[model samples]
Target: MNWDDLRVFLAVARAEGLSGAAKTLRLDPATAGRRIARLERSLGAVLFAKSPQGYALTEAGQRLLPRAEAAEAALAEGRAETAGAGGERLSGTLRIGAPDGCANYLLPQVCAQIGAAHPDLDIQILALPRVVNLSRREADLAITVSPPATQRLRAEKLSDYHLSLAASRDWLAAHGAPDGPEALKGARMIGYIPDMIFDAELDYLAGFGVTRVPLASNAVSVQLNLARAGAGLAIVHDFALPAAPDLVRVLPDRVRLTRAFWLVSHAGPRDARLDRFATLLRDGMRAEIARLEASVA
Candidate 1:
């Protein structure tokens, strides 16, 4: 089988649609579709079952997946072995998926500094409100609030960060600060939508007796904006506090919570370029979180 055709097949399988696979491979949608058709003809077997929802792999495709992945890994290993043969800087795209809060507040500076040092490297950050699917190739790397439970992926703890109840100075002036959790009664709370909380780690208000959140958003940035606009008190990441200078922590001692960030990626052969980049990213996150939190403190 043509390796290029297999590569296209792998991309389609991961993306689950021609358009998405085309985007990832930098090919036109028509071209991607034609390639898949050609591959099926050559193999004399159907690879995918098409539906309005998306492409679903056929039994043939399922059987072919492992062999294709092995070939892909071998090619990746070869590339890694020859990477930077002449002291060349890291080039090509590195896409990271992260929760919107971390994506909005943490990654820009860290990625900017990395891009500055390696001018050829292109970085893409997907500020998704849900868990990034590594199996779907949604991102080359993902920064998650909790470690993935799947054994197919590898995860490393980056840093532990804090969150505290905060409200706009204007809101506090009007409503008065809550002395404790019990004092939160009758307060207009801002937080994630109850049923839309995707991860257990994101259910920040669970133990605080906050049964209702009148102002809610799945995206942390939006919640922060609501708090900044004096809508109500919300739990804000300590590293994100500097972005809203008008906001002040309420019940800091009693209502504070701690969480850690995990760097997650597909388990595979080590690539020197990715290793170096991961190191820089990990250290940058530690420093940035410390700096931002200290400024708020």
Candidate 2:
């Protein structure tokens, strides 16, 4: 019946492991386990079934999930209301999940500015190569290359960014620039591993008839580094070009592609502070992309 116990239960359910839940809550694993045991004793029902894989919720645990989530949301709403009433700066944690490319190139500056304004805000950027799982509460918000297909999440287009074939100046100078996309067949290519691409938007080389990549990685930052090292031609984001001055577009006119970033979050009532933060994030990303792209142009 204790709200704190319910909070611990929700964390364990989402993380699917006591250690992970304990890490999130900043508690010792033994302490978290004891809390769960206490909660089960109070409810007179076993909540989790432990296994080698992890914790699996029991029927009783499943039943309590939604109600626990509602209580958590209500607590968040109350905090937001109190903060607004007092005109206090944004506090507590905000975790954002994003592909490594965006996380590395875009978010640091944007988040730094937000953090500067609200010194109390604790922002964590999870630069994961795969799509962030909002359903499991991996992150409070996510920036994705494509809009999520699920109805449980809401998506908003933040910006359209360009990408094109690029290679280091030295590489082009040594091997000669490709006359067009067709000439790329002879060049060493760097791109995402064919089977490892997590999203359709990340399959940047497929449309160009590129079925082979001699050098490949799932992470964009790694591909960029390969291109920068003069390993091969790779499709590079225009906004990211500023970071690698040695690299230049190879076939800008004939090989240009456009993609967008979507701000994705769980669909439901949210804290007003989150709403304001989202606005700042959206506007900041748009401006940063434009400014970076223009600099390279």
Candidate 3:
């Protein structure tokens, strides 16, 4: 089997669609589709079931997955070994999945430093509202508020981040800042949509007495932006405070919450590049956390 064709197959299997796989592999949809078709023909098997929802792997494809992944891992090990032999810095894409808040507030700077140190490395930061599945190879590493429960994954505490009630100066002046959570009743509150919150850790408003969120979005940045726009008060992460200096902390001492960031990766033989990259992430996160906490202080 052609390794290049198998690579395309692996991308399609993971993405579950030609277009998504194409985009990820930086190939046009036509090229990706053609490659898959060629691979299927060479193997004499239908690899995927086509449907409106997306591509679903056939039994043949499922059977081929583990072997493909093993080959990929071996290739990665070879690359790492080659780089080490040359006494060169690690090179390749390091994909990180993180919440929108962390991605927006913390990762850009961290990624910049990582990029500067390893000019050949490409860092792909997926800063989205939904969790990235490391098991599916969606990300090489993930920064999550909660650790994964799966035994196949290894997690380490990255840092503790603080969240507190905040509102814009204009909103506080017009509506008066709440003395505590109780006063938030009937207050214009910006938060995650009640039912759409992807992670339990994101259900921040549940701790408060208020059940309804008048203004809501799944994205943390959207909630913070709305708060800055004087729409309402929000439980904002301290790291984001630098972006909206006009946002006044409301009852910082009384209404405060802390969440731990965990660095998660799949369990397996350690890759030199991943280990070095993880170190960079840990140091960067620690520095950023200190900077953010100091800003609030």
Candidate 4:
């Protein structure tokens, strides 16, 4: 039997009728019925019983489901692989998903390099709240602080960073920067929630040779917003805070902490554009981190 016939039968079986199958596959009722009829004839067995309600799978149809499903899966995979194989010029669209901070600090340079090297390529840099699954092809490339343990994917460390006790320039000016540990008690503290990895920055709080005024641990992203709005002092990842025109580092010596960045992508299909894109990102980010480190020093 033809794959189309089996596919129509499977859809009809699942959808419960030719009408539903046609709706699902964007086909007409007559077309779906014709294909199903052809498949049953080719198999020399009645695959379905049409009742007033819809199509119900017959014993023969039940037997054929597994084989038909396997064949459909194989065909889909073959089509994806064939479509994925393309030249090394990086002419197609590339989607890179990253956290807000990375998008702010690193993306511009990466975009510039990619644009210059591959003028025909369309680079879409999406700043998302969650990491998309590279294994499932949710994104072409992902930059994250966490990496998954999967053989189907490849990952690499991009750079390391510590947290910074930061606040807006207005907040620091009005509050008067506290220089010593004793002055921190009751200090308005902006913080990331305890579950986040950057919560390590909280370790350096008032008790660790420091005391803050009214300390609180909030989520990092939220804390950044609060800090920017001059709400309180947040221990932000050094890489997370873009150089804000209104914000400034406060109590830098009070919070000493560090973390790493990782780049992740799929290993299969070996998308040449993604490979070149990741290499470019690593190189650019490393240089930017070095410059920031020097400035921090």
Candidate 5:
């Protein structure tokens, strides 16, 4: 229950014997034994079964060992990030993943800025729609809309952005723009193929009466390209829409859609580098959204 008890338990579990644990803990062998006994007594469990070679942890001690070590590790991280530890330079690899739109927009900017600020830190970026697996260490940080439920991971809502359907003026002139969701029933839609990254966007659009006419390009870039060329309407995030001048918004009133992107990381001491990068991203995105609204206005 006490920190000392846990520390003593960890010392013995790691050291393999009371004598070795005593040396590690800077205490006498009998004192180490006494502490272990008291720890076991407090919990009403046997900590170790003695042998000629060393002490072997009982099932209970084996179970307790990992938890105690994790607690210690977490505690150390907490101390490192505390008030007195100001300007603790982060020098470690931080793996991160986010959706492709982010990669296209601000992923590089954020990474470059953070990398410049913290010269010793290395960053790896993976951009995809599917949530990265924190349990498998696929990423140390993630930006996604996925709900966070992993045991040792943390997640928070990062920011929100809007989705828009765009089509070239000529495309609209030929096919005529849909006045309502029902009108979309006959219009050609540039849908992502079944297994592509933006398939979920197509699924969302299907509810709006926009049936899939499947464009030849399976990639989002190609879909946007075709949309710009007056091929068909493509659903795209507001962040990536402005680059194409020819593409105009299609039935904004009928398109009832908004999505929140979340930022996730392994739960522990607050990562200052990640924290700084998140603030930069959040502010930049807010500015971008405001600019988008102003342009529409």
Candidate 6:
């Protein structure tokens, strides 16, 4: 039950092998093996079963893994808290995972300002089409269209943006805009590919009583671009349309929908770097949310 031995055990559990764990811990393979053995002996359990494939965790290891990882995170949190007490420049990578539309349209300005403020810190934005797994430490922070329902995670409304059905003026002139909600069923609709709809919120058309989308894509940008190209009518965020003068909202009053972006983080110990960045992000978003809502209004 030595803390050092537990650290070695945790590393091996993650790396799944002695050599990889040794590489990670910067310990010789022999020493790493000895640490694991010591931990196993102290705990009186066969923690891992070695095989040709790798070291697979036994029941004891499986049970201890989460506790050990939690301990590691707690230790890191202590270090981050200590560092936060001093007024030193933060120098580490902060990874943020966000959906495509928000990542593309909202993040550039926010990230630019953040970069200017924290030149020593590297910000990595992973613009993904799907939700990131915060439980597995996939990202330091995530902006999700839907609030996370998972335990040990904190989620707050980042901003509420307006969505509406839109099409290029050229397309509207060519095919004609739908006169009513009933007519929209036959309109040439561009939307997310049915199976690729990661979040239920992205299923904008279904609520409008439209079942068929003739042209579709997994990416929001592609759908927006397709609408801009006069291919079809699309459900798009109002904030993304301001620059594209050709696209016009089809049903200004009737078809409007509002969705909020939720900022989510693991409910682990707080870090000054994360706290500062979150505050910056939150404040910037508060200033922009009104403009975004007004654009549609």
Candidate 5 C-alpha error for residue 228, in Å: 1.6
* lDDT score, candidate 5: 0.68
TM-score per model over all chains: 0.70, 0.70, 0.70, 0.56, 0.60, 0.68
Better of 3 and 5 by lDDT: 3
In the range 1-297, model 1's lDDT, one tens digit per residue, is 899899789778766789867865679989999999999999999999999988989999999976776675455445444444545678899999999999999999888877766779999999999999989999988999988889898777666688999999999999999878886656789999999998999888877777889999998999999999999999999999998999999988898897888888888887787877786677677667766886876
Query: Model 2 reaches what TM-score against the true structure?
Result: 0.70
TM-score of 1: 0.70
Please give, for residues 1-297, the per-residue lDDT of candidate 3 as tens digits: 999999888778756688867855679989999999999999999999999998988999989966775676556445433443455665888899999999998999878766766778899999878888998899999999887888898776666678989999998889897767788777788999888888888888877777989999989899999999999999999889988899989998898897878789888998887977896677677666666766786
lDDT of 4 at 247: 62
Best by lDDT: 1
TM-score of candidate 4 relative to the true fold: 0.56
> What lDDT is reached at residue 256 by model 6?
84
Clashing residue pairs in candidate 6 (N, C-alpha, C atoms within 3 angstroms)? none
Off by over 4 Å in 5: 1-92, 112-121, 149-151, 195-202, 216-218, 268-273, 276-279, 292-297
- How does candidate 3 score on lDDT? 0.83
| Root-mean-square deviation of every model | 15.7, 16.0, 16.3, 19.4, 16.9, 15.7
Clashes per candidate (backbone, < 3 Å): 0, 0, 0, 17, 0, 0
With a 3 Å backbone cut-off (N, CA, C), the pairs that clash in candidate 1 are none
Clashing pairs in 2: none
Which stretches of candidate 3 lie above 4 Å from their native place?
Answer: 1-87
- Candidate 3 has its poorest 10 consecutive residues by lDDT at 76-85
Q: List candidate 2 segments past 4 Å from native.
A: 1-87
lDDT of all predictions, in order shown? 0.84, 0.84, 0.83, 0.67, 0.68, 0.79
How much does candidate 6 score in TM-score? 0.68
